[model samples]
Target chain A: MTYCVGIKLNAGLVFLSDSRTNAGVDHISTFRKMIVYERPGDRFMVLLTAGNLSIAQSVREILQTEQLKDPGGGEPVSIWNARSMFDATRVLGQAVRHVYERDAEALRHSGVEFNVSMIFGGQIRGEGMRLFSVYSAGNFIEATAETPFFQIGESKYGKPVLDRLVRPETSLDEAAKCALVSMDSTMKSNLSVGPPLDLAVYEVDRFASEKLVCIDMSNPYYRMVHSSWGQKLREAFDSVPDPVWQGATDLPLATESCQHKPLRKIGRPEERLI
Target chain B: MTYCVGIKLNAGLVFLSDSRTNAGVDHISTFRKMIVYERPGDRFMVLLTAGNLSIAQSVREILQTEQLKDPGGGEPVSIWNARSMFDATRVLGQAVRHVYERDAEALRHSGVEFNVSMIFGGQIRGEGMRLFSVYSAGNFIEATAETPFFQIGESKYGKPVLDRLVRPETSLDEAAKCALVSMDSTMKSNLSVGPPLDLAVYEVDRFASEKLVCIDMSNPYYRMVHSSWGQKLREAFDSVPDPVWQGATDLPLATESCQHKPLRKIGRPEERLI
Candidate 1:
């Protein structure tokens, strides 16, 4: 199991991934799921993967050298020398297809689905930052202004905070904070998604970034964030007044105040709400 | 897809279920997923179902009359006549297995898996409150004091809050509020889980309750909860300070005061965390 998220905001790109991988509960191990490719001032791309670790590792191994042939008899297009992020993602898709062709049959014989998903996003010299979610089928979808983020693996536990906080216009630091908070929630609720975490904050158009760090259990900033967020969330929850079932309170629990009808009770076999 | 949660607290029990059901995204409808049975001053039981609606409906139909023959040469045990909550759950499991035996093969031929999950909880006269999560195989796991809650379908998005808030000591109203908050989170993230919702809160010894309500978009309390929670959540998020890469701010992002270690970065392909 893994948890990875990528956010492409107007300010920059934010990527985060957990390092836990498990074949079963008894066979848990740390496996880094992020790869950074940088040719300063030319191209900068980060890949975050989830699903079968072997397949993702194989795809990564093939990706650096995998190429799509030119129909016009020119040099093959690879991630190293793609003109646009679209072309680079196409090369990645080809790499995934190559791995699938090599391993899918044997894995299928053992009843394993060829499951792999990835978030590939970064900036190239000519264009702004772009983010994409690549599926096992070698198909992908790009982030848009309407939905500027993508998540893979243990995504649901952490999604509400992202839904509440992230937007295209969010600041880079704010998005980073939001991502960590989301990760914190996931880690709290799910045993499979554990730290130390890998976090990268890339400023759009820089073509390179120095804001990459690995966070472990002992990290000071994360400790503060984790503890403070949980405490504050509890405070927030408590601040809200509990529903008062009786009359004349600030908020009443009864359905009479609202247009909605009360729930129907079926006391007998033929009793129905409709 | 659906989202239903049941929490067993020392004070009582809380149950919540969304009404949205969809064959596909194109065929969406509202179908209540909760059923309550009460023999005043004797027993109170609630069932929340998720998975194939047909299977659940079948199980529900059979459950009313489903019976298990006593090992001793005596009468049968039906949920209506069970002496204990455990016996009632056993009857529910038998009903599920009956439905599976009738429909699973046909459903499998059509490439649909025979899947259903349920959260059943209540008290039967001589016994204290008990909660069980019933699966398709007719086996069930009871919720304990350590794990006093069970959720079925689209559950993860709503789990973090429940994990944080639910305890054996939690009040019935608080548990109900927590369940609603959990549903709110699930609805915010997944379109498949929606309202109008069915919620019921029952006290441990009270064989009947008036706290059952069908909360719709027009429900005043729900509207207030949704808006206030969303607003308060956002405000809580904003109250957390943003990360400062290198600063002397009151809550420094990269402080050296905690036990956790900073994140490690790999500048080259060969540089690995392991």
Candidate 2:
């Protein structure tokens, strides 16, 4: 299991992924799920993956040299020489297809499915930044302003925060904070998603970023974000007034007759609910 | 899809459920998903349902008359005649199996799985309060002090708060507040679970409860829980400081060379990753 999120905000792109994987409760281990591809002053891209570890490892292993034949007579396009992020993602999709072709049959025989998903986003020298969610079928969808974020793997536990705080106008540093808070909630509820985490931020058009870092339990900023967020959240929850029932106070639940009809309680053995 | 939760606290039991049901996003409708059977001074039980609406509806339809043969050679036991909550749950399980026996094969022919889940909790004369999470196979597990709550259907989004707030010592009204907050989070993230919620609360040793009511968008108390929770959650998120990056602030992400080795970035086309 894994939890990875990539946010494409107007300021830049934010990528965060947990490093834990488990086959079952017994076989738990750490496996980094992020890769940085940067040709300084040219292109800066980050890839985050979730799903079968073997298939992800296979795709990463062969994706480096994997190439796609250009319809026209020209040099084969690879992630390295691709002129646009679109073509770069095509090379990645081809790499995923390559792994599927190589392993799907054998895996099917053993009762396993060939499943993998990825978030690939970055900028090419001549174009604006792009973010894509690549699927197990080698298909992909790009992020747009209306929906500026993509999260895969154990996403729901951490989703409410992302839905509330992230938007196209959110700053790079603020998006980073939202991503860490999202990851913190996920790790608190699910044991499968643990540390150390991999986080990277790319400013729009930089084609290079210095904000690639790893976070373990000991990082000071992360520790503050973790503890402070929990305490504040608890305080916020405690601040909301409890529901006051009928005869106790003046509120909706405080009256015997609410705006809506009350739920019927069967008080007799032979009462017909219909 | 639906979202339903039942919690057993020392003060008593709390139950909450959403009514929205959808076959597809286009085919959405409302159908109440809770049933309360209470005989004052004797017993009180509430049933909350989720999953394949057909199966749940069928289970509910037949459950009223369903009965289980007494292993001790006494009279047949139905929910009405059951002396213990455990025996009552067995009667409910048998009702589920009967529904499965009648519909599972045909449902499989139509490519639908025979799936349904339930949270049934209450008190019976001469016994303590009990709560059970009934599964598709008619099997069930009880809630204990350590794990004091059960959720069915779109559960993950609302789970973190329960993990943080629910305990055996929580008061009945506080548990009801927690349940509404949990439902509010689920509704914010998922359209499949929506308005007109049903909530019920019972006190220890009481066979009936007056805190049974329906809450729609117009209900003032629920409206307060809905709006206040969102505002406080946003405030809590903003209260946490952003991560301090290398050179900007002294933090985990603040140093170019972190305690953990930085993720290796590929800077050249021909760099060997292995």
Candidate 3:
């Protein structure tokens, strides 16, 4: 299992990925999942992957040197030379198809799905910024303004935070903070998603990024977020009013005069459930 | 899809279940997932089911009248007649097996797995309160001091709070509050789990519980929780500091002198990923 998130906000893009991987509980290992491709004055791209590690690794390796035929018989399109993020993502999709053709049949014989998914996003000199979620079938979907983020692998546990906090207009620094908080929530609940995170922040239209960093258990910012978020969350929970089961309050939990029908307990074997 | 949780703390037990049922996105209905069997001063049991609604409803119906034959020709053990919470759970397990026997094959023919799970807990007069997670195979596992809660269906999204807060000594009110917060988190992320929730809280050693209530979107307390939790969570998130990508803070996010090696951006097509 893995957890990786990529957000394309108005100000910038934020990418975060956990480094833990496991074939089973006893065989867990750490493998970083983010790779950056930068042509400082031309383009900057980041790839975050999850799913079968072998499949993902193969796709990533192939993508570095992979290219696609220019349907118009021009030069081959590769991530390094693509004019737009969409073309770069197509090169990635082609790489994934190449890996599928090479490994899918043998993997199927061993009962393994040829599965890998990726979040590929970046800014090319001529365009704004773009982000896509590429699937195992060599298909992809671009993120829209209304949905400015993409998450891959073990996504649900950390999703509520993103759903609530991430927005197209969020600032670069704040989006990075939200992504870390989201990752922290995920790591707390899931053992398979462990430490040693890879994070990169790219300012929109910059055509480059210098905010690539690795974080582990001792990273001060992360440690503070981890401890303080839990403490503050508990304090927030403590502030809520506990239900006064049968009593009156501003909000009656179960007042005798309430309009909605409450569930009636069955007092005998023959009683009907209402 | 569904979300139901049963928690046992020193003070008592808490059970909560969402009432939404959907065959797909287009076909959704409200079918309550909690059933309370209470014979005051004798026994109090709560059954929370998740998975196939039909299977769960069938098992609940069977459990009401289902009986297990006594090996020595004593009276059959039905949930109503069971002497211990454990015995009542066994009756529930037997009911699950009966349903599987009758419908698993037919369900499989339609490509539906015999998918169901449950959390059954309560007390009989002579023993302490017990909580269990029953499986599709009719097997079950009891919650203990180390792990005093069980959640079924769409559980991951809501699990972090329970992991952070619930303990053997947690107050019943706090646990109930925590359960509601957890449910709120699940509903925030998942469309399949929705409102019209059923909640029941039981006091330890009490043979019956009178706190079963149905909560809907209009329920004032739930409305408060929904808005307050979301607002407070956002406030809590804002309380944390944003990442200072390159410049120095007390906790340097990516200072030039940092010890860990940052991810290097590949500047050329021939560059190797390190």
lDDT of 2 by residue, A1-274 (tens): 8999999999999999999999998899999999999988999999999999999988887888999998898999999889999999999999999999999999999999998999999999999999999999889999999889999999999998888778899999999999999999899999999999999999998989988889888878888998888789888888988877755555656443345566788665466665
lDDT for predicted candidate 3 compared with the true structure: 0.88
True lDDT of residue B4, candidate 2: 98
TM-scores of the models, in the order given: 0.94, 0.95, 0.96
Say which prediction, candidate 2 or candidate 3, comes out ahead on lDDT.
Answer: 2
User: Which candidate should be chosen as best, given TM-score against the real structure?
Assistant: 3
lDDT of 2 at B152: 98
Estimate, for each residue in A1-274, the C-alpha lDDT of model 3 and write its tens digit: 8999999998989999999999999999988899998888799899999999999999888888999998899999999888889999989999999999999999999999988999999999989999999999989999999889999999988888888888899999889889988899899888999878899999987888778889877777777888898888778788888767655578766654434577878777776664
Q: Each prediction's Cα RMSD?
A: 2.7, 2.1, 1.8
Q: Which regions of candidate 3 deviate over 4 angstroms?
A: A255-260, B246-248, B255-261
lDDT of 2 at A57: 89
lDDT of 2 at B134: 99
Listed per model, the TM-scores of chain A against the true chain A are 0.95, 0.94, 0.95
Task: Order the candidate numbers by DockQ, best to worst.
Answer: 3, 2, 1
Which runs of model 2 end up more than 4 angstroms from their true locations? A247-251, A254-261, B247-251, B255-260
Query: A242, model 1: CA deviation in Å?
Result: 1.7
Q: Residues A1-274, candidate 1: write the lDDT tens digits.
A: 8999999999999999998999998899988888888888888999999999999999987787788999999999888788899999999999999999999999999999999999999988998889999999999999999898999999989999899889999999989999999999999987899887888999988998888877776766777788888777877787777776756865566665434456655454444435
